[model samples]
Target: MTTIVFLHAHPDDESTQTSGAMARASAEGDRVVVVYATNGDHGDAPEDLADGETVVHRRRVEAEASAQATGTQQIVWLGYADSGMSGWDQNDAEDALHGADVDVVAKQLAAVLDEEDADVLVGYDWHGNYGHPDHVKVHHVAHRAAELAARRPRLLESTMNRTRMAADRQARLDRGEKVDWDPSAPMDDGNPLGSTEEEISWEVDVSPYLEQRRAAVRAHESQGDTAWMRSMPDEEFATMFGAEYYIEPGRTEPIEKGWPFRPPD
Candidate 1:
């Protein structure tokens, strides 16, 4: 069985960004593993947090539930603190993911790749999809880890299709629906969200796994950021998240519908 590892910036990130693909991989009998770079300590705490229970503990539990919902075979944590968004003072904390030594973290990740004999290593784009500090670090660490991995796994960068997102936003507006997410709007790093469609290498259709993706996202109930997704209509969610995009670094071929384990047509 092909082993695929998805390296994410935080606990809930995999749910939104890669859960559909994870579900699809697992359903097809491949081993799917998710690695979180941080404990997501910076996430908002829910009102129902147990006495003496920290957000970190709660998030860890939630992440496990998310993995279960996505049918992931295993979960790994790099054991770093969550660095708050860009420019936050916590970003400089010694234990924060954003401040961790890239080489050190990469080595830790490389060990996992070696142990898993990972055939595919999925990470974020160079801009971290939206330029969050921890995410940007993930981009660096993932590349370095791939280089250090004994198996030299094929690396794929998960990202959004900005061109398509922008088009969808306009289409929503035309339909008299209010759109809150604008692909062209500047994000944490002052760059727009996602790469253009022309910059993408593959579009993996995961429409059949949408329900699993939704369940995964719903698992992270403590995170307010994903609340909207939990309440979104099935059809709308399918329209917005039915496909996952990736950029295969140094790939010069035209973009096509493909999965990491499949050969190009």
Candidate 2:
């Protein structure tokens, strides 16, 4: 079976970003593995976190549930602490993922790639999609690890269709609807969120795995209702997340209509 490894920034990131694709891969009898770059020790604390319960521990538990629900064959952790947002002091923490040496982290991740013999390695887009510090680091680490590994796999970078996001927002605004977050707002590196549609290579239709995706998302209970995601109505959730997008390595060929597996040959 073909093996694909998805490298993500945090615990819940897998469910929100790559679970649909991972589930589809596993369903097709391919082995799916998820590698998280950090333990998410610095995320927002769930209101119900038991007294003295560490955020790291809580997120790990949630990630495990997410992995199982997503049909992931294995999950690996990089064991780094969360590097909060761009300006947070946590970014300076000794163990913060953002502060870690890229070479050291890349070497560690390369070991996993070598161990799994992955056929494909999925990473974040250049700006980490939304410019989160840890997310950006995952992008660097993933690509660097692939380079470090003697045997390289096809590397794909996960990204949002910023073109679609803007279009959807404008359509909503025209309909007298109010959107929550502003995509054009200054993100982590002062770049716009996601990439333009023309830059996107894969617009994966994950609709068939919607149920699995939902279950995987729900598994991050600590981030579920407490986070902004679970508050969405079922239909809205499906509509917004039914597709995943990616920028294929070395190929700027415009995206055509197709699912995840049909990457540019």
Candidate 3:
């Protein structure tokens, strides 16, 4: 069985970006693990949260629910604090992971990969799925960890195809919907970071896991625009964004067809 590890920056990152793929892989009997770089303590606070303790506890529950919805067997926390987004004053805060040693973070990830004996390691593109500092840190550490693993797993980075992403954004705009399409919005690029569509080595057909994906997304009510997602018809949402795209490392040639997760003959 292929052991896959998905390294994410926060609680909802997995669900919003790659839960479909994670669910589909788990359904196929792969041992899939979700590793969150932070506890997401800064994500949200209950209107009645009396103290920091309550907020932390609530976030953990939310993460657990989200993990369960994605069919993840285990959730590993790197025990770091959220670094927030770029240019934010907190990005430079002493307690933030952004200020932590790169080697230290990479070592923590390497330990996880070793313990799991992962055959596949996945993370966000350099843009960090929106240029969130924690997201970028996770991507960096995941790659470094994969490189240091005794038995290096295949590394896959998630990304959006330029043409398809643009079309999708336009579709939303044409509907008179408020869309976040600013080019300079940290990581909202019209194209894949450092790659083209032809360079994408894997496209997981996640149609079967769409509901699970939605459920995972809903589990993170504190983060995503759940109401906006709920407003859309299931079929329409799934049809427009059903599959997760990836760029596989060490693959000399681009994937012409077929799932890349299948074992070699």
lDDT of each: 0.92, 0.85, 0.74
Which residue segments of model 3 deviate by more than 4 Å? Answer: 48-53, 171-196, 224-227, 250-257, 262-265
Q: Candidate 3 lDDT, tens digit per residue, 41-137?
A: 6776657555556655777777789778877899888888887767778778776887778788888888888998888888877767566778777
Q: Pick the candidate with the highest TM-score.
A: 1
Candidate 1 C-alpha lDDT tens digits along 1-265: 8899999999999999999999999999999999999999989999999889999999999999999999998999999998988999999998998888999999999999999989999999999999999999999999999999997888899999999989988988999999887889999999999899899999999999998999999999999988999999988899889999999999988788978653222
Instruction: Kindly report which residue pairs in candidate 2 clash with one another.
Output: none
Model 2 regions more than 4 Å off: 224-226, 259-265
Per-residue C-alpha lDDT of model 2 across residues 1-265, encoded as one tens digit per residue: 7889899998888888888898889888999889999998777678888988888888888888887887898989889998988999999999999999999999999999899887788999998998899999999998899899867878889998888888888899999998887777777789989888988888888888988888888878776433566667878888878999988778868896565552224
Distance from true location, Cα of 79 in model 1, Å: 0.7
Among these predictions, the greatest lDDT belongs to 1
Collision count for each candidate, in order: 0, 0, 0
Candidate 1 Cα misplacement greater than 4 A, ranges = 262-265
